[model samples]
Target: MRKITHKKAAAVAMAAALSAALLAGCGSTAATTDSVAESTSTAASESTAAESTEETADESTADEAAAKNCADLIDAIYVQERTADTDARCEAAKAAWDALTDTQKEMVEGENADPEYFGRDTGDASKDDPRNEDEIGENELLVVSFGTSFNDSRVADIKGIEDALQAAYPDWSVRRAFTAQIIINHVQARDGEKIDNMQQALDRAVANGVKNLIVQPTHLMHGAEYDEMCEAVDEYKDKFESVSIAEPLLGEVGSDASVINADKEAVAAAITAEAVKTAGYDDAAAAAADGTAFVFMGHGTSHTAKVSYSQMQTTMQTLGYDNVFIGTVEGEPEDTACEAVIEKVKEAGYTKVVLRPLMVVAGDHANNDMAGSDDDSWLSQFKAAGCFDSVDTQIAGLGEIADIQQLYVDHTKAAMEALNG
Candidate 1:
């Protein structure tokens, strides 16, 4: 079939599967499994098409269903809702979501649009005082987000983080800024969200009579985006006279331990608590017993901080999840990382496998690359190798992480401080 356009690629990949399977017979499922194998959030457009999000009313449980190899081993990742009584469906769903890659979550979050993403409106956000003549006050926070095309989800994911921060520091006034221009226009056109530009957000902060400009980015890591944000902060450095950028959610300076700890805690408290349990399962033991290997797809970066993925994997293993492994789309644990995992499962005599993404959204990669039924996907290759029996998956994403979300809150809190200081 002819290649799809950039805009439609992500939305239609899986939908194309029917056609792909019909024309190619799912052979090896190889041609472009890599096509869907996007491992980074920024590159999600290159990830899988819309993921398969479903809920099978007939399946007894994900475990039972997968035990029966209830699926074809071609493509990867399908976030579906199942009514089966498998341990704790809620927990399972939570685990499924936590397992998404950063890229997956971003693609999903991208669904949010202008005013649709956020609640606040820009009734009159124009900067009457075009110049910054007034003294920048303290007790101010600056929320920096990658910005989204989908207003509603963007409000929840990024702005929600800001709101959390605002709540934490009730004394400080929070001003929002969109690092993306398209998103700003979108807000103005749709929801009347009044953020004009970095200048406007700053003017609003000054108008609020705040000084401290605590800048926090809702980015997954420290890379070009983070760097640009830093630069942006510097550009406005003299204006505030007091500014500091907070650590990114998944950055080198960010507390990986805290992030992962939040992950474990979120899983323990989620609806699927029964399956994963408060006392997480023994990774090596589970791997040995089930003859199953677990692979996590992370939203990795190409920056020097990319090593964080390896560190995260090490941290998970340190948590005694010997069978639990982490890989990224942009950095370490490249595609071949799965080869080692496949080897381990083979050595354990397990013919089947379970693959999940460790992300905030069940977007492109999570659905098509990691779990689609196409031949070239991770699921396809594992099945082809003959050691993978079944792959059970979900798409709950990481939006549920209280601490991760709190990270955003913290940034805003700090930003508020910068504004008011």
Candidate 2:
């Protein structure tokens, strides 16, 4: 049913205006009988139009109320209302899901009808509120990421970064935002954890009268997401007295490879340590000596920035870490695909392999594409190659690493210093 919108309200007002004009016409004198008949006929037509419009307005009011009910039901999927209404909200959400058309369902891109929508209550609704408090200080630090919907990853990776920033800069209140709307929706519907987007986060900073603002992005590199985050900060540059943005986890990509080289070494150290421990080896050297190859799987894109993956591989090799291999899901650099990676490892005479995500969060790509039991998954294809004796995976994101967290803190410090400078 189509809801009565502002357009319908305008139509009702137009009908009322027409009725008043017809009344005034009846009061006017007609020069001829034909003129009088024509005026009378116009009055009848106007009266009919007014009555028809009133009937439509009445019907639309009911439809509008019904539409509101459906919208509320859809909202319940994401919102954690009062404690007492939880059960009723779940039931209403189901009913609303059933009543929605395909178009309405598309509007709800999250898990709206899931039992978990009302199942696991966090017990505090205020925690999920974007604008939890109206109180604001002069300085604000907004942390942004292309977030993960996985609850554990969200807490371990995203929250971990935010907590680090908050501790590092006690004067600046650290708020959170996610670039991925789908992840935001999924998290809200699945765990009732509401997060702000780029615009909303910026708007909140402005509304709170924050003068000095710093945007710290937790992205891995200066990829598409990072570029977009920079654009958003630039778009709202005038909203604050002074606004600055930090370099991503990895610093800028330039002709010189020092920054990315440093990042590659850091990641290599962090993940190699985890993979070694997971393999029951003493250390990275021990694992390397044992002929165990560590594969870092990144979520590659078709963007020109795909060279980052290739650059990582080069950095590793230049650092003399022959045991480390880098590959991507989309095979962006062409040679990083599962088949190509398997061939490389095989040619290198490595019989054991350990896989981990090169991404900030070990979410969907890490869980399914890399390690899942599906026949076409990386682990599966590697196993099918009949070369390696053992294959393992580490399900931790880069954000979970302490050294990586400190790296982000260092970047935040630089950005803040630049702002102060």
Candidate 3:
């Protein structure tokens, strides 16, 4: 009985020990599983945070790329040459600009592209017509110019001529063309206005099936631009039944400096009269008597037609207007240079000088070169010379004058007569 009792006790002890071991193992297994689960959860959270950070970085990079693309596009279209892709590039530039956010637009920059390129108020473009419309009748009068980007000047000067032509030739359709592709591109990009280049304008005329075409150039003289315009018109002459290009504002550029024509005299007389009146003088003689001299600044050209400036000076001399002077920005004739003109004015003993642009439109050359505050500008140079008591500038072009417009009208009439003859 004692042996059996001891055996039962030992068996009981073994069973209890086994049960405790099993319970301890289960507790350790549960703790390990919980630790693994916690580690996995922490790793998942880290992965999610890393993904978000990468996404944010990618978004930032994309925005920067978009802004850069917009800037580059603007730079691409701000060019002088028009290609098959020019229109498309211009549209792309506008689109890219539109796509940029406000912050991105503020960051935009390029060689010729800036925030104000399309943002600046250059007057209401709608006030002026592009004259690029089609569906023309038989007779088409195409008025061509070197062109200006200034909206107000364009309307007052170039459009003034166009309107006059339209009114004068009510039987014909008047169109417009610019010789400077740069100006055309600028107007297009900045103001959403498209002025046709010479080639485009001629092609447009041919496409319109116009039988009679008269090209009236608003150029100041027969210079390089005039030559190029003639070349362009020559190509399309066969397309029209009759094609005639009228003389420019200065008429035919004579062979030499001594060759003065009626056109030069008219221009000299008209401009001087206008300047004298604007300066509160009764006439050129009165202005001269008052110790004041008028200096007319022209865009001196390298072409042989540059003699026209010299001829104008001669015409002024012939008119006995000793106080009136002629100068050129390019200093082509050497005598008409700003320095030379200043010496002439100083030697002539003029106390006051009034500067005016002799060019057709009071555009860049008139505003900046003739009258700008820059040191190299004519106004600044005249002031710096200390030769005059007071220097004043008239920011007016020849095209603004009624007499000048009449001269164009007369030239056009002559061309039209010749075309019919």
Candidate 4:
């Protein structure tokens, strides 16, 4: 969880050293000033104020330096053993891993139980190996996801989920499938990589002699995209001597109350805890206090966006955050739902609240819509309702957060276990 690279660590060290120097210089000046001013005027009060400011500044500087140390993965290689051509990257990645501690290395090379599968124990080049095809057994697992659009971001979200599933089922040969039509199309169009369709990805595995295919979607919930994936998978279910496509993320069986609670807690903590720490909301204890409200803005879809937003609303209530509310730029559980929140704040008399995004990335909605304070934005409307003098906003998206993605990983593990059973 705590990730750092050499370069990042060095940068942080340099920053901390600089901050230390500044603080020491300030300390020297204060010593001189305090000694001189003790008999002149209100030296104790000035000294107290300086000490508090210094403490606050030290904490802020530490946080900023730590944030800077989160390592840019642009230089790191992922997707090892993907195919024959992938060997160079694979080797580089292995070397990179060899240099890291066990924990740091796990971030690169997966921590899967290393359950030997039927496939060849090969590196990135094995995709082209005929012998590699001979290596796979019939009982194999394939994990599908939206395949992150951000090249670097993909390493954790999709790949991390795949690794966890592999660790859970040590015997199953696990693979990855991305349902991100737009993203895959872009990758294929801009880059010359031969991206596979759902059927094509399946066929590739089948051609490699993979049997007992277990296709599991890593989506957040069931919707059109999930249904479409099932359609693609069913067309080839008969191709395998034995095949069963597992449920999508939050599949029907996963909707139980306990599971839902775990998911909601993970989601809420994933999105908000970092925010509360990152923004120093500790001083705003009153905001998290009872009767205090928080508005979450979800990206509304023309078709099935309501499903995610509505479920998210229920999840918030289940978390015991009664003042929590969800609204979208489109669809029912409409903006009027936000209006109702304003009415509540007006009546029950809460003066301040926080706004956050309920989508993957803050990209456009969080910036231009929810917190923009534009007449059309939700915060602007809340302001008009006289709910509070100020409304703070967090641009963090649930998908961008690693812990939230683990929830998807958790779903994948459950579904794979079911298929294994």
RMSDs, each prediction?
A: 22.5, 16.0, 14.3, 19.1
Instruction: List TM-scores for all candidates, in order.
Output: 0.51, 0.71, 0.80, 0.53
Give stretches of model 1 more than 4 Å off. 1-138, 147-156, 178-209, 250-293, 331-354, 360-362, 371-385, 407-421
Ranking 1 against 2 by TM-score, winner: 2
Ranking by lDDT: 3, 2, 4, 1
Top candidate on lDDT is 3
Q: How does model 3 score by TM-score?
A: 0.80
Candidate 4: C-alpha lDDT: 0.54
Off by over 4 Å in 2: 1-133, 256-260
**What is the C-alpha local distance difference test score of each model?**
0.50, 0.74, 0.86, 0.54
Best by TM-score: 3
- Candidate 3 stretches with Cα past 4 Å from truth are 1-75, 92-121
lDDT of 1 by residue, 1-421 (tens): 2224544664465456545445654555564453334323324534433222222322234534342221111001121112233223323433433443443322222223111122233233332111223343465666666554343344444555666776786765556666665444434333334453565666676676565667767666676767877876677677655777876764453444334444243332331222233224443465446555566666666566565555565555555555555655443535326565567557756654556656544445666677778986667767788646676654334444455676566545454456446
Q: Order the numbered candidates by TM-score, best leading.
A: 3, 2, 4, 1
Instruction: After the best TM-score superposition of candidate 1, give how far the Cα of residue 213 lies from its true spot, in angstroms.
Output: 1.5
Q: Which prediction has more favorable lDDT, 1 or 2?
A: 2
lDDT of model 2, residue 75: 61
Number of clashes found in candidate 4? 10
